[model samples]
Each structure stands twice: as structure tokens, then as C-alpha cells.
Target chain A: MPDLLPENTPFAIARYTPDELKAALRKMYLIRKFEEGAEESYTRGLIHGTMHLSIGQEASAVGACMALGDADKITSTHRGHGHCVAKGADVSRMFAEFFGKESGYCRGRGGSMHIADVEKGNLGANGIVGGGLPIAVGAALSAKRLGTGAVTVCFFGDGANNEGAFHEALNMAAIWKLPVVFVCENNKYGMSTSTERSTAVRRIATRADAYAMPGVTVDGNDFSAVSEAMDAAVARARAGEGPSLVESMTYRWRGHSKSDRNRYRSKEEIADWMARDPITRMADMLVEHGIATREEIAGLEAGADREIAEAIEFAKTGENPKVAEVTRDVYTEAVQ
Target chain B: MNMDAGTLARPEQETRELSYAEAIREAMDIALAADERVVLMGEDIGVYGGAFQVTGDLVHKYGTDRVIDTPISELGGAGVAVGAAMTGLRPIFEFQFSDFATLAMEQIVNQAAKVRYMLGGAVSVPVVMRMPAGSGTGAAAQHSQSLEAWFAHVPGLKVVQPSTPEDAKGLLLAALEDPDPVLIFEHKLLYKMKGEVPAGHYLTPIGKAAIRRKGTDLTIVATSIMVHKALEAAQTLAGEGIEAEVVDLRTIRPIDRETVLGSVRKTSRLLCVYEGVKTLGIGAEISAMVAESDAFDYLDAPIVRLGGAECPIPYNPDLERAAVPQVPDILQAARALAGERV
Candidate 1:
């Protein structure tokens, strides 16, 4: 269990102790397994509404969240299951939400699209593109105003880069010197349109230059690389140096949503990304770095699979919301 | 309708004559002084004293931290206000013109209104938005609009169009105390109109109608600027031996059904007036409410609705005057309803 890597190794891998490294790898597996279980349940018609899966982007979700704690907050995107699992949410409750159960995160009102754990500082996953940008800036504003010293990370897609909210939110965060990190999970395609076809800049990170903040692009599949970029950005924000943008270059193995026909891209393109599976890469890295043996990695995978299986059972057994209480919670009855 | 109105100031409470704009500013000033959590955000709301001067000198008093001047980004600024409200800060966002609300509808309607419900009441957006609404100053089609109907159509939102200074100050203070998103549409023409306002904190309960004048012949139900016009028409109707009751529907949503129905039952004739477009507007809702209730059986004649012309507010002063329901328009409608003609 001794540290086998040299000092010149990436800061993320080098700085983490053996136990922390294994925990990080475990989360990547849990995120992958959670989405896989959700997809299987969806096919079996257990979930009513549609869901957006983050199958190939587990590393970006887990690595960006490595620096966050209960005090820190994150505003997620439509493809946000991985981010939710990465942020320490109970997968059982998430599956309960997908099953439209009363014990779900939103009491079955918000299905797959809007699960939130405010106690854990997950400000809910947004269904709108670029919807969470300004909200993240607002959360950061609260952090600075209340002197809580908490930072907010905004996870968005490549398509959201073109939204007016993206420009406006980035500008406000920069000018206010608020504690926030803009994490763009660029998966090459916004539905069927590629970044090359839709965006003016080659890299989504380059758009951050216009807002006068530091911007960087990293290999999203590489856990150490993504973690290292997020760590620096989170540190800068916590120190009150204002916000920064980090674009994680990854790809979605599946279509945008359940409705997508997969006619936009080739099977070869999908197979190519599958070959570079982030989970497999992370598992191999742990073995090569001597942090965990092959058998230990297998134990983590099996453990995640077991947890997902139990989560589905918990979701299926949870009670359905009352038909009469459908109109409740439209407005908070409690006076502040 | 939910809480008692804070009208008729107590014997110990003092009053002063202030314009509607000044009343709104006083309410904001009182809220900022009372609560450290309260913050104001808008375009040119700082040293500029706000586009309508409703936030006059507040920036100097509260500084930039509390009286924030956001960039020309309504959507982003509104979203910030919503986020701040959700995370323990009370933000009073100002849209320069009510027309600008269209730009920020996504944040207002989707995020602020639905946040608590979407999150299963885990969060409440205690955000208040002030919009200088209605047309009269010839700002033309773009700047001049009575779009409260749009917000009223959405359930999670509370819409109030305060027609007087007293309601303006009291309703804003009340909105700050409420745990939901509230939109206050202060008519552009009413900003300078002065009235006796209570000196300190008082809440004119949301979802209540005020009886400006009582009569026996017919009921004139109105909103915003039309409330004033309806009162003027009531006076003229009284001289014509027609007793007309004037009901100021201060709150657009949660439409004070009991007050309106009781008035219609007493008077037996209803004239619905508002400044929004004639089709699918506040007037239509009032008319439909009366028709659906027992008040329908009490009616002496068919209900009449007088609203804005089915067109954008024109640039011409004469045409602008003709666009919305003026005093004469209300007078004619009230007289016809009182005449007992079918």
C-alpha cells in the first residue's frame, strides 16, 4: 500500500492517499452502474418519463465533484445522474424518484429530470439548457454575501455554451468575483450537432476568454487530468479569486435521450468511444499505479452492481404519491 | 383573501402623503433596514436611482452590496434573484419596464415559480419583482404594456397591480414577508400620483378587493389604472341617478372571488374593466367568474367587459388614449349596464 508513483505524477493521483483513490474509483463505478440500472428499468417500463443518461462521462462527473463537500454547491444539467451520484446522493432515493414514488427526492413530482438534495448542496438538475448557469452564480453570490466561504460548480453541456445565459452568468460571476467554477462537459455533440458545426471556437473553454477568466481543456476520460483541473479552479474560487471555466472533453456512448434514433452518428463512432471506456481506463490506472490489485477492482465493480440491484428494489417498493395532494407544494406554506 | 388587510392605520400609526413611486421606495427602504437578508438587483438601480426613480438614493444608503446594479441582462439578473431567494437571501428584482419581463419569463415562470414545487417544497423563492407597467406616457408599444395577465395565468406566481400609493407600499412590504414569488405591476401613470401612506411597516393582504365606492344599481369591477377610471365613472353615474359600486381588484391572481361575487349579488349588474387586451384578459376572467357563480342568477342584464383595444399601444397620443379603457369608456359601459338593457 506504499506510494509507488514519483513526485512528477499528476497532482490528483499523487496527492490522493491510497484509500481516497479507491473511493474515487468506486464512485465512477457507482455512477456507471446507476445509469445502467436506470436504462434497464426504463426498458422494462418501470420508469414513466424519459431520462438522459451519462454513460461515457462518469470520469468528468466524479472528478469535478472530488473537490466539493457538503458546504459547496453544484447546479447540474439534464444529463445529471452521474453528477448526482458523484455528489454523495443515495442511489436508492434517486431510483425511488425515477419510479415516481412518494419517498423520492421530489415526492414523485419531479421525475428523472429534477432530483435535488439541498442538504448535500445539490441544487437540483435542470431540464433547460444553460438553466443552471445564472442560478450557480446566485448560489456563489450567497456564499460570498453570507461569508460561508463555499464555492459552486456549474455543470453544463457544449450546447449550453451558445445560450445567452452562459455569457451573462459568466460575466456576472467574473465581475462580482464570486466563488464559482463553470464546468462544461463537452461530449462533442449537442444532440446531433457537433461543436465544430455549432460553436465558433474549436474548444468550448476558449469562450471563457471573452469573460476575462482563466479557461482550460482537459481529457475528460482521464480521471487525474479532470480532477487536477477542477481542483485548481475550485481552489481559485474558494480563495475569492473569482470563477474559472474548465471544459472536459468527453463523448456520450448513447444517444442524447431515449427518443434519439442514433441515425445522426455512425456505429463506428460509438464503438470508438466505447473502446476508450472511462471506467475501464480508471480501473486499469488503479492497477498500474499499484493502488488496487485486479481482484480489488473487481470487488468494487461487484459492490456497485449489488448496490444498484438493491436500489431498484427499494424504488419499486416505495409508495406512490397521493392523487389528492398533487397540487401541494406549488407555494411554500411556511413563512420565512 | 388569505390574510387580513392592513388598511385603516392604527391610532398610534402616523401617515404622510406620498407618491406611488415614493411609497414603493419607502417599503423597500423599510425592508432593507429591517432585514440584512434583503437585497435589491436591477439595471441602473444604483446611483441612477432606478429608471422610474422608485429606488431613489437607496444605493447610497445601502451601498452596492445590497442595492446591486446588474448589467443589461434581465434573464440572468432575474435568475440570480431567484437563486439568491432559494439560498436564504431576499432579492427584490426590478424590471426597467414590464415589457422587459418577456426576456426574463424563463427565469420568472419556469425557475422562480416552479422551484418550490419542482423540489417538493424543499425550497421557497421569496423573491419580489417590481415592474413599471401600463401605458400613458407615449413610450409606445414596446415599453408600454399591462402584462400582469401573463403572470396571473401561472399558478405558482402571485401577481398584484397596486393602483394607489397605500396599496403600493403595503403590498410590497407584504410581498417581502411572504414565502413565494410575487410580481408587483406599478402602473407608469400611478408613480407620481400621491396618497396618504402609513409611516411604517404594514401589509395590504394579497388576494383582496377594496370597495372604493358603494352603490345599489350596478357593480364596476376594475384593476390597476382602470380602478381610478371606474371610480370617476361611478361619480358620474351617481349624478345620473344610477348608484354604481366600484371594486378595485388589487390582486390579479387569486381573484378575491367572494368580494366580487358579493358585490355582483348586491348590485345585480357587472361591468368588468382592465387595461390588458380585450381577449383572454382579466376582464374575461371576472366575467366568467360572475357567470359561473350564483351571481349569474342575480344578474339584471348581460355582463359587459371594457378592456384595451385589440392592438399594440400606439405611438399617437390620441390613439393611445383610445387604446385603453378611459373614464368615458367606463362611464358609457356603467350607464348601459345600469339602464337594465339586455
Candidate 2:
């Protein structure tokens, strides 16, 4: 499995098969490539509404999600393509969604930010800062009450950490010992202000001390490290130890969205993070470890390309919702 | 959606009295005991016995699963309740206060209220969000607001406000059976006033208004705390040979226009009172209804509206009282309308 657990780190890697590692790597690459494609399409006006790409922080989303069982629920942020893909949501429907088609998750009413599939336990991508926090907590509450043991993972940005709901939810989760994990993809900026300038807490995880839960800071750039941390968090939650927070130190390779001029950060800073690119690093490790050949990796890349193209095509032929569809699913109505 | 006025006046209590708080507790106990699906979730509901103590000993009696306590996040608690309701389980959520409901409005108004219509009738959000609404506890502006009018503006929501203990239990039980999202705004002051309430499963159909007292001198339509104020005003006016019939519009949305209009026609004088602000309040709608109805021909006086003053609910006790109509405000307004005080 590409020596996923270095002789250095403290977490589980014993059960991971080589194939599982390759598959997870492939999925991360696919999400990155698809999102980049979508961003490009957005500039060309092929996609409508806002696009919050998870290009720079793919590892955090991927690693945490990989640790999740299919039955586990995930609440995602506005930049949720990674969460959706990792949860096994249909890529075709997602693409159709960005294309504003009725065949999409929310029938095009929600567009990119509001896409959701409850069956997959992907509880919508929220537009509000820290908005998805409570929903994930709710899902976790539901799981705990129903005795499902299904964990609920909430993905949010460092920005959400400052919101009142963040503290409120964290406190409650800790008090009740709900099965939830709070993942902060600390890509350093809340829109424009850097996390350092905005937050007083040195480490976001340190704030977990207040909640009496294990607080962690993981190498979010390294998929193995992230996966390890997430595995532990998810395990603790499933065991009913209560909620935990993992502050993933990562950077968004892209601007917050497709419209950035990159002014908030310098080119050198970007170049430094680029050196630790998650996809490239994982790919190189796969070959060095002989887990997969260069050609096999090439084939995987080729497959991702074809899949993304087919998704675009699927979206192109799809239709927007019948105007009446807008009023559906927000609440359930009896059809008697 | 309209209740028969004759049916709603089925005697508040033939034998006893109950406080508004006790009435709600009775309702909660009845609901929790009667149906397996009915559960309450909110902050302080468990070990603390609820923030307002409405759920006294519920957690001890029912255990943590049914009378679940939540974190201080209203949005999360409300969202969980909504999610549970979407599944087969029915959930009743308690807001520590009505003012804090704004934090969860995205879930309550956008998600809970509209889920039914948004899903094209595929799902039903039979969630009941109960908030202790209006001012009385000296909680100030942040803690008090009568927002029934806002939910009333929404199409799918069924808004219920009960002034008496009997209606409190009946309406809540009825709200549980309803297929759509129903908001029951229990007033802060009515929690202690006692009255005879039937035991066991019963219902007060949503979207129906109740006529508390009958008179021909004037028709006083009111809600929540204002309903009691209107009744008191009616009694004082009765001694002065100015009879004021009191109508409690229990359900704000889908209001019982027939009951309201019938009294307006008989009295030929209409006065609407609400705990909400005067500007764009429920009184406006009731006044508009009277204006649009055939009862306009029976009007002997211009329709009068009495509501909270156009200002934030002040923190100072006296100022807060001045902001919203008090019992004395109702009496003075009724006397003016009846041409008795002047």
C-alpha cells in the first residue's frame, strides 16, 4: 500500500490492501482533474452559478472520506465536489447538476452549492460559512439515536471555526458524545483574511481542549497522514467516545473559487505547496513501491479523463427541472 | 382549514384551571405517553429538565432517547428534528425562546416548512417546532418576538397559537397528526393559567380560529397573550353596558375567516389585537379580511387595530410593556371603539 504508514506516524494501516490504496489515489486524482475541468468550463460559461473547487485541499477530503464506511454520513462545504465524489455520488448527475439540469441531485434547483443525495449520506453542500456543521451534527445525532453506529463527518473551512454555531455545535457534540468528527480544511484563508490574522488560537485543534475531545493537527498534504488521523477519529466516534476535531493543515491549490486573481497569496507560497502536490506525490510513491506500474497509472489517468468527458456529455444532453420541481424535497408531502 | 365558531367555544373548563406552562406540560406528557413517534429535542431537555423547565422530569421518566437534550445550537437541534421527521419518526422541537429561532430559520422556514412542497409531495415534514413566543418574562428584545405573521406568509406552514391550557394540549396533539410542518407559538404568560382539559388523545384542528366569548357590542379578534387581554377587555366593557365578543384566532395562517367575520357582522364594530408590531402585523391581515368581506356593510365603526408599538421590544420593563399592547391597552382601545370611555 505504498508504505502508507511510515515508520514515523502513529495510526492504523495494517488492513489496507495495495488495491485499496491505488483506488483511493485514483479517486483523488479523478476529483482533482474533474474539478479543474469544471473550473475551466465555468470560465468559458459552460457551467452556471458559483464554483468552489477543492483543488488544493483534495487530500483532506479524500483521506477522511476513504476512512468512512458507505453507511456513514458526510456534510460538506460549498467546495464539496471532493466529498461528493468520495462518498460515491454519481459523477454524471453531479456534472448534470453543474450544468443546471433536472437529472441532477437537486434537480438543478440547488446548483453546485446545494447539491445533495441523502441516500448516499451526502447531506447537501452548504453555502453559508459553517452552515453544514449543524446538519452533520444532526445526522450524527440521528445515527446515535437509531443505534446505526454510522459516523457523520462534517467538512468545513477554517472560516467556519469562527462562527458561533461552530462553538455551539462542538460543545453540544462533546456534551452528548455524538458520533461526529469535525474536519477543518484550514486552507488558511476565510475569503480574504488569513487564519493567522483572524483566529487567536495557535492551533485550531487546541480549541478542542474546551470540548474535552481529542484535538489533532494532521499533515493534510500527505494523504496517508490525513487518512490515519481520520481513521482514528472515525473509530473513536463509532465506539461512542464522542465527537473529535482534526485540523487539517492544507492549502487550496486554486483560489477560493474560479474567480480569484491570486492576490491574497504569493507565487512563491504557491510554488512551495506545489512541491508537495498530493496527487503527484502519491503517484510517485505508488511506482517507487511497485504497487502499480507507470503504465497502470497512465491507464488510470486515461480512465479518469474519459469518465469526466462522459460526465460533461451526460450533462449537455440533460434538461433542467420542470418548473414545478423547484418546490419538491424541501419537505415531504403526503400524496393521499 | 376553518373551524366552526360554535364548535370552538366548547367551554374552556367546566371544572378546573391550569397554567399555560402546566397545560403545555400536560400536552407533552400526553403526547409522549400516547404515541411512540412523538419525541422532544432541545437544549437542557435532559438532565436540566429543559431550559424553561417545560420538560420537567421528562428525561428521568422517558430516558435520553425520547426526551433528548441537545447542544446550544438551535440550527442543529432543529435540523435533527427535521431529519427525524422526514424519516418515519415524528419530532417536536423546543426553542429556548422565540427570539433564538432566527438562528434556525434556515432549517425551520426553508427546510422544514418547504420540504413537502419541494419534494413534489414525495415526503412529508410532520415536524412540530414549538417556541414560547411573545414578551412577559422581561427577556427583552432579543428574547421576544411574535413572528407568526412571517410563517403565515409562507404557503405550506400551518401556524398555531393557543391562549388557553385546553387548546394548548388539543392543538399540539392535532399538530402531531398533521402531515405538514406546524409551528405552535405558546405565549410566555399563559403557561400557568389553569383550566379543565380532557385526558387522553384529542385534537384541535389546525388552521382553525376559536371564539372565546360571545357579545354583540363589538368583535375583538386577538391571538396569543392578546386573546386573554381581549377577554378581560370584554368583561370590563360588559359592566359598562358595552359588550365585546372575544375571538381567539388560534391558528394564524389559514385563519378562520368565517368565525371572525360572523362576529364582525353581528357586532358591526371590529378591533384586531396581536402581540406583533403594528406595522404589517397579523392584525393587518384580519383588518384586510374584514375590509374585503361582506361584513363591511355591517360595520358601524371604522375597523380598529391594536398591536405592539413600532420599536424593538425594549429591555426596560415599563418600556417593553409600552411596546406591546397590555391588558389595559385592550381595555382602553375597546372602550374607545365602543364609545363608552369618551
Error of 1 at A129 (Å): 0.6
Choose the strongest candidate by lDDT: 1
Q: Pick by TM-score: which candidate is best?
A: 1
User: Mind giving the per-residue lDDT tens digits that candidate 1 earns over A14-113?
Assistant: 8688798899999999999999999999999999779999999999999999999999999998999999889999999999999999988889888888
Q: Can you give the TM-score per candidate against the true fold?
A: 0.97, 0.86
Q: Using alpha carbons, what is the TM-score of model 2? A: 0.86
User: Poorest 10 consecutive residues of model 1 chain A by lDDT?
Assistant: A1-10
User: Comparing to the true complex, what docking class would candidate 1 get?
Assistant: medium
Report the lDDT tens digits of candidate 1 across residue range B185-269.
Answer: 9999999998888798888888888887888999888888888888777777788999888888999877889899999999899
Every candidate's lDDT: 0.90, 0.80
Model 1 ranges with Cα > 4 A deviation: A1-5, A334-336, B1-12
Measured against the true two-chain complex, the DockQ scores of the candidates, in the order shown, are 0.62, 0.24
Worst 10 residues of 1 chain B by lDDT: B1-10
